[model samples]
Target: MVPEFFTQTNGRGDGEQTLAPDSSFSNLEEAEKALQELAQVFPQPHSFISGIGLDFATNEVSKAAVPPEAPLLNMEAKYRALVEQIPAVVFMAYLDQGIGEAYVSPQIETALGFSQSEWLEDPVRWYQQIHPDDKMRWSVEAAEMFLSGKPLRSSYRVMARDGRVLWFQCEAKMIRRADGSPWFIHGVGFDVTERKALEEAILEISAREQRRIAQDLHDGLGQHLTGIAFMSKVLEEKLSDKSLPEAEEAAKIVKMVNQAIENTRQLARGLHPVAAEPLGLFSALKKWASEVEGLFHIGCSFQCENPFPIHDVNLATHLYRIAQEAVNNAIRHGKSRNIVIGLSGKNGAGLLAIQDDGDGILKKQASQPGVGLSIMNYRADMVGGSLKVQANEGRGITVSCMFPIRSPE
Candidate 1:
C-alpha cells in the first residue's frame, strides 16, 4: 500500500463529515520529503502533523497533512522547541488504563504548579486533579472522543497542586493506526482562569443591572401605568354617563395604557425570570412559554413532571437563562415551530432540556455555533453543569443541561 497522508483537521465537533485527500506520496522517502516541504505550508510544527498517517501495504504515502505521535519527537530540535514554548499545555496520551499521559510540555508547571516529571510519574494524576464537580462530565466527554475518534472540546475547572482552582479549556483529538485501532491522543489545554474571572464579573454586573431594570419595570412603571389605565377608564365612564363625544378618546386611552402595562410586565419577566423563591423558575418558564406561543405564533410548552426544590437563586436564574437562550435559538436560528422545555430532578440530580422541531442544524453550521450558544454553554458552566447540543432524528435541535441538585447552605 502506498503511504499516503490526508490534510484534514477534525474540528467544529462535526467529525463525521469526510474530508477530501489533499496529496499523496509513492514511498516513504517521498513522504519524508513532503514533510519537510510542509513546514513552509504550515508555520506551526504541531499543526503541520496533528492527524497524519501512512499505510505500509506498498510503501506509498497515504495522507500528508499534520504530524502524528512518532514523528513529533523525531523532528528537529527547533520544531520541538517551538512546541514546548507555546502558550498552551501540549500533551500526548496513551490509550491505556487511566489513559496515561505519555508526554506533556513544561507549561503545565506554569499553569497548574506541577512539573512535567511529577505529572508524568503518576498515571492517575490527571484524573485526580479534576475538580470533583467536573469529573463526571469530563469522563463522559472524554469517552465520546475515544469512541468516535473525533476531537473533544471541553472546558472545566481543575485543582492545582497548590490547591488553587483554575479553569482550563481542553481540546484533544484521538489518532488511530492504519488498521483503525486507537493510537494515542494529541491535545492542548489552555489556562483560562483569568478569562473566566472576567466573564463572571461581567455576567454578574449585567445580571445585577438587569434585576434593577426588571424591578423598575415591575414595581415602578407597572404601577404608574396601572394608575393611568384606572384614571382613563374612570374618565371614559364619566364621559359616557354625561353623553359626551370625548368618551371614545378616553376608552382608547384606557386600552392603550392597559396594553403598555402588559408589555412592560413581559419585558420585566424576560430580564429577570427567577424570583425570590426557587419554584419561581417553573412559573416563569410556563408564563414565557405562553408568551412565545402568542407572540411568535409557535407551539411552546414547559414540562415539570417532577420538580424538586432548588433553594439557590443563582442556580435557578442560570437554568432559566439556559432554557431561554435555547428556545430563542430554536426560534431564531432553527426556525422552529414547536418547542418543548422540560425540567426534571431526582436523586439529587437535575436536568433542563429544550427540544424543538425546526430546520435543525446543517452539518457545517453545527460546528460553528453562534454567540447565543456559546453563552448558553458558559451559563451552564457557571453553575457547575454541562450543556449538550445535538440534532434531533429527523428535524430539529435539542439543548440539554445537566447538573447536581443542591441548595446553598
Candidate 2:
C-alpha cells in the first residue's frame, strides 16, 4: 500500500507534519523531500496535525480543514464578540452535506432552553423542542421549501431549554456549492411571543362584550316590553263594549286604543322576540309594511321569505329596525303614496330592501327631520352589518341592508 500524506501547522504560523507509513519508508530521502514540499506550500505555524494515517501504497494527501493560527479558537472568539455587541444572539452552524445535522449556535442556551452541544449531537432535537401543535405544520412547510431549493421562512414556537415557551420568526436560505448542490443552511431567529399574547387578549375582550350585550337584549328589556303589550290588549278589550252616551266618542277611543296596542306590540318586537321562535326575519318586514300602510293611508306591499333561527340577536334586531325605519321615513318625509318592501335570505344571508314612490329628497334639506334612518345606520354597524340608502329612480326613495350571519373569528 502507498502511504497517505498529512500536514498541519504548529505555533508561529509555520506548517509542519509527522508522517507514518504502513511499512517503513523504503527511501528516507524521498519521504523527507515530500514532507518539506508540503510544509513550504502551507507554511502556517498555529495549525496542528491532530491525526495521521497511511496506507501501504499510493501516497496521497487528505487533511481536515483545520486552519493555522488556532482556527476553532479564533472562530469562537469572533462569535462571542458578535453575540455581546449585537442586540440579538449570534449563531453559526456547520451544516452537513445532506442539509441536516447543523451545529446550532451556543447562544441557544440563553435564547432558548437547549444547549448547543445537544443540538449538534442531534439536529432533530430542535424539532422535538418545537410546540406540539405548531410543530407538524411548520416542519412540513420548512421541509418543502428546503427540498425544493427555496428560501426558508417560517414562524413557530419552541420550548426553551429553560422551560419557557417562546415564539420565534426565522429566516434562512441554503448555501450551495459551485455545482449547485446544497452545502449548508443558515438562519436567524427572534422572539415574537409577547406580541402574539397581546393580540389574543384584545380579541378575548371584544368577544366578551358582544356576548354580554346580546344577553341583555334577549332577556332584560325584552321581557318588560312583552308584559306591556299584553296589558294594552286587556285595556282595549275592556273598553270595547262601554255604556257611553256618546257612542261615536266611544268608538273613536276604542279605535285609538287598538292602534296604541299595535304600536306597543311593534315596540316590544323591536326590543326582542315575543314568539320565542325565530319569527322568520321576513315576517317582521311584512308587519312593518302593513303598519305603515294603515297609519299613513299609503299603499304598501311586502313579499319576503327566509330561514329561521338567526342565532345572533343583535343582527336580527338590526335587520328588523332597518326595515321599520325605511318604511317610517317613506311615510313621514317622502310623503309616499305607495311602498314596496322585499326581503330575501336565500343568497347565504339576510337581505332587506325598501322602496317607496314619493317626492324624493328635498334638495339641500338639513337634518332630514326623522330619527329613524340615523338609528337604522347605528344598529346596522353595531351588529357588524351594512346599510344602503338612496333615491329610487323617477321620484322615490330606497333603503337596503344586508346582514352577514357568520362572525369572523
Candidate 3:
C-alpha cells in the first residue's frame, strides 16, 4: 500500500508542492484517473501515486538543475582564503595584455605596508616602488625571465608605503598561452630584510677579523722571524771569518730563517691584501702571479687590456681574493702546469678571469662544491658580481668574475 502523507507548499522558491490523497483508490484505473486530475491542477512535472501499490516508473520525480554560479562562488571563496593565509604576497599579472596586475593576495598589506586596493589602483606602481639603485638590475632580470619563460629568483629592495626600505626575495614563474606566448606571471615575494641584515653583519665581522690576523702576522710573527734571520746571518759571517766548516751550516740556517720570514709576509698579504689599495688591483695581481710562479714553480702569468684602476679598495680586495682562490685550486687540485690571469674593463664593468691548463674539475666535485669554491662565490656576491667556474672543452678550468663599476658617492 502507498504510504499516507500530506504535502504543503513552503514558499521557499524550490517549486515544490505537497498534496494529500482525496480518497483511497482500490484499483489502478481509479488511481490513474485521480493522478491525471492532480497533474492538471499542478501543471508541472512531479511524482504521483498510480494505485494502492506504488509504481516505481510513475512515482519517480526529476530534480531541478543546480545553478552554474554555485561552484564558481565556492572556488572563489577557497582561493581568497588561501591567498589571505599565505605569508608571502601572491600575485598574477597579465603580460600579453598591458602591464596590469590581475590579482594580488591580501597579505600585500602585511608585507609592504600597502593596501590591496592601492596596489591595484596603479598599474606601474610595482616599477615605481623599487629602490632607485636596484631598479635597473631588477628590470633586466624580470625582462629576461619573461622572454625566456624561465623561473625568476631575485633579491632586491623596495620602498614600502611607509617610506621604509625593505628587502624581498622574489620567486616567479611565467605562464604561457596556448600559442606559447607570455600570458601571465605568477609569483610570491618573501620579506628578507632580517636575513640580509644578518648577512651584512657577518661579512663585516669577517673582514675585521681578517684585518686583525693580517696585522698580527705582519707586525708580530714577521718581525720576530726577521730578527732571527738577521742574527743567524751575523753568526754565519763570524763563523766564516774564523775559517770553520760550521760557517756553511750556519749560512743554510740563515737562508731558511729568511725564507720563513718571507712566507709569513706573503701569508699576511694574502689575508689582508694591503697592496690592493696602494698598488691598485692590476699591479697587485701581477705581483701575486709572479709570487705564485716562484713559489710553486708553475708558469703563472698576468695580462691586462686597457687596465683601468678601481678606486674602491674593498671591491678590489674581494676580486683579488676570488682570483687567488681560483688559481690555488687549479694548481693544487687540478695539477695545472700553466695558468693565465686576465683583467679587462668593458662597458663600465670589470672582468677578472683565471684559466689553467690542467685536469678540469670532475663532474662530482662540480655538483657538490667544496668550501673553497663556495667562498669564492660568496665573495663574488659580496662585491655585487657573479662567479662562474666551468671545465674547458679539452683540459683545464676557467673561473670568471664580472662586476659593475659603481662611482663613489
- Among these predictions, the greatest TM-score belongs to 1
lDDT of each: 0.81, 0.61, 0.78
Alpha carbon lDDT at 338, candidate 1: 97
Candidate 1 vs 2: which has more lDDT = 1
- Candidate 3 residue-wise lDDT, 193-281, digit = tens: 88877886787788778888999998999999999998999999999999999999999999999899888987888778745453388
Residue 27 in model 1: lDDT: 78
RMSD of each: 13.4, 18.8, 12.5
User: C-alpha displacement of 399 in model 2, angstroms?
Assistant: 0.8
What tens-digit string does per-residue lDDT give for candidate 1 at 28-129? 677566665554455563453444543333434555543465565557566768989899999998775453448899999988899999999887899999
Model 1 scores worst on lDDT over the 10 consecutive residues at: 51-60
Instruction: Choose the strongest candidate by lDDT.
Output: 1
Compared with the true structure, what per-residue lDDT tens digits does model 2 show for residues 79-105? Answer: 766765544434445445432444455
Q: Local error of candidate 1 at 252, Å? A: 1.5
Tell me the number of clashing residue pairs for each predicted model: 19, 16, 1
